[model samples]
Target: MSKIRVAVFGCGAIAQRRHIPEYASNPNVELVAFADPNKQRAEEVAAEYGGKAYENYEDILKNEKLDAVSVCTPNYLHAPMTIAAANAGLHVLVEKPMAVTAEEGEQMIEAAAKNNVYLMVGHNQRLMPPHVKAKEILESGRLGRVLTFRTSFGHPGPEGWSLDGRDSWFFRKDEALMGAMGDLGVHKSDFIRYLLNDEVVEVAGFIGTIHKEDTDVDDNATCIVRMKSGAIGTLMASWTHYKGGDNGTVLWCENGVVKIGTGQGDEVIVELTNGTVETYKVGAMATNEKQVPSGVIDDFVQSIITKTPPTISGEEGLRSLKVILGAFESQDTGSIVKL
Candidate 1:
């Protein structure tokens, strides 16, 4: 089997920690190029990760002969870069917050389809072992129908994660777009949407910059959602968990409540209404301090090689982003926004 020629369009934290490393480790992938505005950083990664560095993504799309590319840039650049790569006939695996707007995401989807290339969003939560287990339990319907749920994804902010620290693009509104909502909440939106196999039909949310000092975007946010299955849920994202982080979900069903990422040492704990309890060891969520290799890059490469659609397709990203976009609208309008 021939290796898939691949390139990374950003050389930052996500690229370094997940995409580049994972791609390098994938036997089917031949890491060929790296692109970044900072030529030096790109060169540094290229030297270690086995790729030629280019300062501009356009250069890579225009010149390289590659089968796939990973768009790991800031939230704002996701759609444009992915569209360009697709138009150039390269498959894409882009990071979350697919685009600033669903319309932009649509353009990306259209480009990928028009060019007959695959577009996969990096909704890595779908690949989390605990989340996979949760999906299985929910599908069993052992707890009956899901009635309500609550999920949270937060950290100390991206400062520690980014190489630039406090000076990272995450603190800049124009670059990062929104804060915790985009950085963290979007992940919950994707995961929750997947777990329930339902779409959020309406959203009522509160977004704020209450905690972070001098930040133009919100550092904290919470949204109440009504899903198509008639399930009502609360989704929250924050950067102000000064004490620690709460990245987990709790589902309340007619027969029981299933908790994923809640208990210590037990990532998944399911409690039935009958008073029976169960604990699952599906592995822990990836943390900044102790990160795990994600399956995103490998899946993207395999989808291209197998001529199959990616699980987290461009459409999936657009659909999940709709809930987040609606939440922003609801926050601004002080009322519920229907999808």
Candidate 2:
């Protein structure tokens, strides 16, 4: 079969670090074009990775012979870009928090459906090997029914992660929308939902901007969720953990507790009520400076080649996004929100 002609939209940190490199490595993909409002970034990526660069993303859709494109733009732009790319008959691998608004997410999902293209979201936490193993254990009923859980993803902030440092779009409400909730909390929501095979039914949350100076978006966000199975969980996303970053989850279950991303290695530790502890080594989580492709890109390419649906479909992204946006509503009202 011929390679899937691919272009990358938005030449930001994610595009340069993940999408571009991963697609370059995938034998099934042919790098055709790159685009960003900042023509320099796109030109740089194209120079290193072999592609034509365009300042206007529309040019890629109009000119490139592409089967897929990864949408690595800011949060607010995800829906429009995904919709446009899908409408162009190109499969899309979009960043997480699929859209800033659930309504936008729905529109993106509908666009993909109408255009007959695959739309995948970059909730890469689920691709962490331990997370994959955790899902397996939960699905096998090895941990019994989930009772409650706590999951968190925290780090110093995008100042350390984004290419533009503190001046990055991530700090602006006009650009990135909400901060940690959209950035990390949404990822955790999706991760927990996948790990438990359940959906968030309700949310109670607190969103704040206690850390970053001159930043309008929330730097910290915490939410409690009730799952469809009557399981309750706490989800947290923070960009002010000055001490150290922790990305992990602990699930208390009827038979035992599933501890994920815990300890030295990327291990999922299962502790039974009977005091039996079993640890499974999956793989290490990626960091900003030392990131590798999170398997999302690989899965996307394979799904296209096999004529299969993406595992993290646009609808899947919407469900997770609902929890985050619902968290915002809960925070605003200081009450519970039913998803």
lDDT of 2: 0.90
Q: Which parts of model 1 are misplaced by more than 4 Å?
A: none
Per-candidate TM vs. native?
0.98, 0.98
Clashes in predicted model 1: 0
Candidate 2 on 159-265: residue-level lDDT in tens?
A: 88788998899998998998998889999999888888889999999899996999889999989999999999899999998776889899999999998876853
TM-score of 1: 0.98
**lDDT of each candidate versus the true structure:** 0.90, 0.90
lDDT of 1: 0.90
Q: List runs of model 2 lying over 4 Å from the truth.
A: none
Q: Write candidate 1's Cα lDDT for 129-245 as tens digits.
A: 898999999999798999999999888888889988988889999998888998889999999999999999999999999878877989999999999999999999999887668
Worst 10 residues of 1 by lDDT: 261-270
